[model samples]
Target: MYYIGIDLGTSAVKLLLMDEKGTVHKVVSKEYPICFPHPGWSEQSPEDWYAQSIEGIRELTADCEKEMVAGIGCGGQMHGLVALDDQDRVIRPAILWNDGRTAKQTEDLNQRIGKETLSKYTANIAFAGFTAPKLLWMREEEPENFARIEKIMLPKDYLSYCLSGVHCTDYSDASGTLLLDVEHKCWSREMLEICGVSEKQLPKLYESYEVVGTLKPELARGLGLSADVKIVAGAGDNAAAAVGTGTVGDGKCNISLGTSGTIFISSRKFGVDAHNALHSFAHADGHYHLMGCMLSAAACNKWWMEEILKTEDYAGEQAGIHKLGENQVFYLPYLMGERSPHNDPDARACFIGMSMDTGREEMTQAVLEGVAFALRDSLEVAKSLGIHLERTKICGGGAKSALWKRIIANVMNLKVDVIASEEGPGLGGAILAAVGCGEFADVEEAAAKLVRVVDTVEPEPELAAKYEERYAKFRKLYPALKETF
Candidate 1:
């Protein structure tokens, strides 16, 4: 049988078709517009997501046997607020995960409500991008829309609901909402009240690999697919990517370098850092994990190359960068403010130590190195909790860079394992679909069989030491500029 994976991303929806053996048959992507009504705000239409996903799925299965598709799973952008009205219509454009308009709301939650109390309820402190803060923002700034909200959905869960006609979400995705009691795998009543939402307003929660419902008969028939195709409650993108890379077992790790960067550490036991710096969320494998998310990663490189440099030849621009850890320039990768560890929405990106001698190459190298350093900051927090890891599976757009991989490996002094597929959430969504259809016993079994490690980037002792010194300097820059931002 075949399985389908839907990756409902911030910019586009990517559909992937795979067989029971985990072989990818075809993949199709459809782009949509992102709206910025004001500075630091990001929004997208849920209608666009649903329409493009339907089109992408149709295109993805065009040459394949649509009847053979047994299951469908979604792995999508986390924490975007997708509100629906009494008639099941979108209340407004979704507040995206990258949106920083909720800084004031986040502050109130962390300070007035108290981090300890919030963490006790949800296993995480509020961030500007978290759904709870967005809820507060809506109540304060858009009272009319907030009053009309009958259902609150995460970005990917909205797609699931559209396809399956079931208002449901998986634990991994729900964890980012700051409405879930992650340790207990349920919605927190305290958080619900705080957000001024009732339990009925939330979607029913499920395990990521569990079947939510079958595809809607209308949707299935329209796409020439079986009506019985199972819709699995898929994961948030990071958790889904972890599943794709086989970062399921205890102590396993996966580092993603997409628009945002994350160091995801899978753990069988539930754990939270003292500062609530790392997110303690339920994993797709029915366990737990800690994740540190930075607002900018490959995005810094993209902005530098495309916007600042006015070129798309990323490879050519990177070719000039030879000195790994010896550059004098330093960059703070906080283009979209920061999350993990700092949790400061006021933070901004900057290049320091630039001199007359510094040219395009040196500045470019700093952007790459800066992202690695920020990831290391999160790794340091994980280490503080005694979750020691010597290696991590790497994925996402930035992982395609061999130079960046070497820099990441050396900067954090850990082996970077390159997986066979860089499909991340899309492949992970398919794997979950396979598991939900009983093609495998569970997520771990499916992951073990489907995911493959093709290469390893090892950190050299000498280079590692050089980055260690440079990282120390990068660490101090953020604190010194905190007031400036």
Candidate 2:
């Protein structure tokens, strides 16, 4: 049987087709526009997501046997608010994860309500991008629309509801909403009251690999697939990517260096840091994982290489960066504001320790090293919780760079494992679908069979020591500039 995996991303929806044997048949991507009505705000139409996902699926399976498609699953951008009215129409454009318009609401939650109390209820503290904060922003800024909300859905859950005609979300995705009691795997009534949302407003929660409902008869017929095709409650993009890379079970780690960077560590037992710096959320594999996300990662490099340098040759620019961890210049990778340990939306990117002799190569190396040091900041938080990781599976577009991989490996002092297939969330969504269809016993089993490690980047002692010193100085720059930002 065949399975379909949909990665509902910020910029586009990528669809993938796979069979029971873990072979990818086809892949199709459809891009959509992101709206920025004001500075630091991001929005997208849910209608666009649905239309393009449908179109992409048709193209992805055009030459294949559509009737053989047994299940469908989605891994999507987390924390985007997709409100619906009683008639099931989108109430407004979705507030994206990169949106930073909820500074006031986030401050109220973290200060007035208190982080300790919030963490006790939901195992997370409020960040500007969290769904609960967006709800509060809507209530205050758009009262008329807030009064009409019949359901509050995450970005991907909106797609699942459209396909299955079931309002549902998985634990891993729900955990990002700051409305879930992650330790207990249920909705937090306290957070519901705080957000002025009710229990009925939320979708029913399921584990990532559990079946939510079947494909709607109309949708299935129009798309040339079976009506009985199961739609599993899929995962958050990071969690799905972790499963795709076989970073399941205790002590396993996965580092994603996409537009945003993250360090995800899976654990069999529940754990939360005192500062709540790292997100303690349920995993796609039916366990818990701690994640630290930085809003800007490879994006910093993109800005330097494309916008500043006026060139698209990322390899050519990176090829000039030969020396690792020895550059005197330093950069702060806070271009889109920061998350993770800092949690400061006002934080801005800048270069420090530049001199007359500082060249493009030094600035480029700093951009790369800056992101690595920031990732290490979160890894330090995990280590504080007594979680020691010596190796991590790496994925995403940034992972394609050998220099970046070597920098990350040495800077974090961990072995970086490169997988043969770097499909990330799309592959993970298909694995979840296969597991839900009983093609495998569970998520971990499916992952073990599908994920393959092809190479390893080991940290050099000398390079690690040099980065260790550089990281110490990098950590101090953010605090020094926090008041100014």
Candidate 3:
């Protein structure tokens, strides 16, 4: 039997087909538009997501034996608010995870409702990008839409609902919504009340590996698929990526440098940072995990390479960056404000310490090193909590750059492991689907058997020392410029 994994991302929905032996037969991607209606606001159409997802899945399985496809699982972008009315129509464009228009609402939640109370309820403080803040924003600014919200969902779960005809979400995805009781793995009733929503309005929650429902007869027939195809309750994108990388069980870590960056630490016990800097969420592996997210990681690199520099030759540009940590220039990778420890939506990207002789290579080196330093900010928080990490599995587009990987390994002073297949969340979703269909006994078993670490980048002592000194300087700039942003 075969399984399908759907990664419903911010810009594209990537579909992957995997056989029982964990071989990916075909993969396809379909893109959708993102709208910036106003400054600090991001939105997307859920209808477009559905359309593209179906189209991508069709293209993904076009040449394969469709009858062998047993199940489908989705790992999707987290924290987008997708509200539906009584007629099951999208009430508004989903406010995305990177959207920063909910600053006022987030501040209100943390200050008025109290951060301690929030941490107690959801194991997290309210952030501008969280679904709860977006809900509050809708209630205050668009009362009509708020009143019509008969159902609320995260982005990828919306895709699942359209496929299975069952409104459902997994715990891993729901964790980012500010509405789940993370420790208990259930809805936070007080949070629902605070958001002016009811428990009934939320989707039914399940562990990520659980089967939600089967594909609808009509829809399955339309796609030349079986109605009996199971739709497994999928995880949020990061958790799915963790599964894909075999970053399961206690003390395992995975670093993702996609559009956004994350340092995910898996654990068996439920724990929260006293300062609420990192997110304490349910893992797809039926455990708990801590995640630190930076709003712009590879996105910062993309901005510099494409929009600013206007070139596609990333390697050619990076090739000139011979100096690792001694560059005087610095860049703040806060292109979409920030998340994790800072949680400041107003934070903007910056470049400091540029000299008259500072060439393009030095500035570009700052961009890569800046991202590495920002990632260490979250890692530092984890270290303060005594969750020490000596190494982490690295993935995403940024990890493909050897120079960037080298910079990160030394900056964070940890071994960077590169896996054989860096498929991200699509592969994770496929693993979840396979597990749900009994292709393997559980997630850990499947990952142990399927995922393999192909290479490891070790940190050099002298370079690590230099980066440690530079990181100390990089840490001070954020505080000095906090009021400026």
| Estimated TM-score for each candidate | 0.99, 0.98, 0.99
Can you list the residue pairs that collide in candidate 1?
A: none
What are the lDDT figures for the candidates, one per model?
Answer: 0.93, 0.93, 0.93
- The list of candidate 3 runs beyond 4 A from truth reads none
Candidate 3 residue lDDT tens string, 1-485: 88999989888898899888888888888999999999988999999999999999888878888888899999999999999999889999999999999999999999999999999999999999999999999999999999999999899999999999899999999999999999999999999989889999999999999999999999999999999999999999999999999999899999998889999999989999999999999999999999999999999999999998999999999988887878999999998899978999999999999999999999899999999999999999999999888989988778889999999999999999999777779999999999999889989999999888999999999999999999999999999999998
TM-score between candidate 2 and the true structure: 0.98
Mind giving the per-residue lDDT tens digits that candidate 1 earns over 1-485?
99998888877888888888878888899999999898899999999999999999888988887889999999999999999999999999999999999999999999999999999999999999999999999999999999999999998999999999999999999999999999999999999999899999999999999999998999888999999999999999999999989999799999999888999999899988888999999999999999999988988999999999999999999998888889999999999899988999889999999898999999999999999999999999999888889999999889999999999999999999999888889999999999999999988999999998999999999999999999999999999999999
After superposing candidate 1 on the true structure, give the runs of residues whose Cα lies further than 4 Å from its correct spot.
none
The TM-score that candidate 3 achieves is 0.99
lDDT of 2 at 168: 98
Q: Which 10 successive residues of model 2 have the least lDDT summed? A: 317-326
Provide the clash count, candidate 3.
0
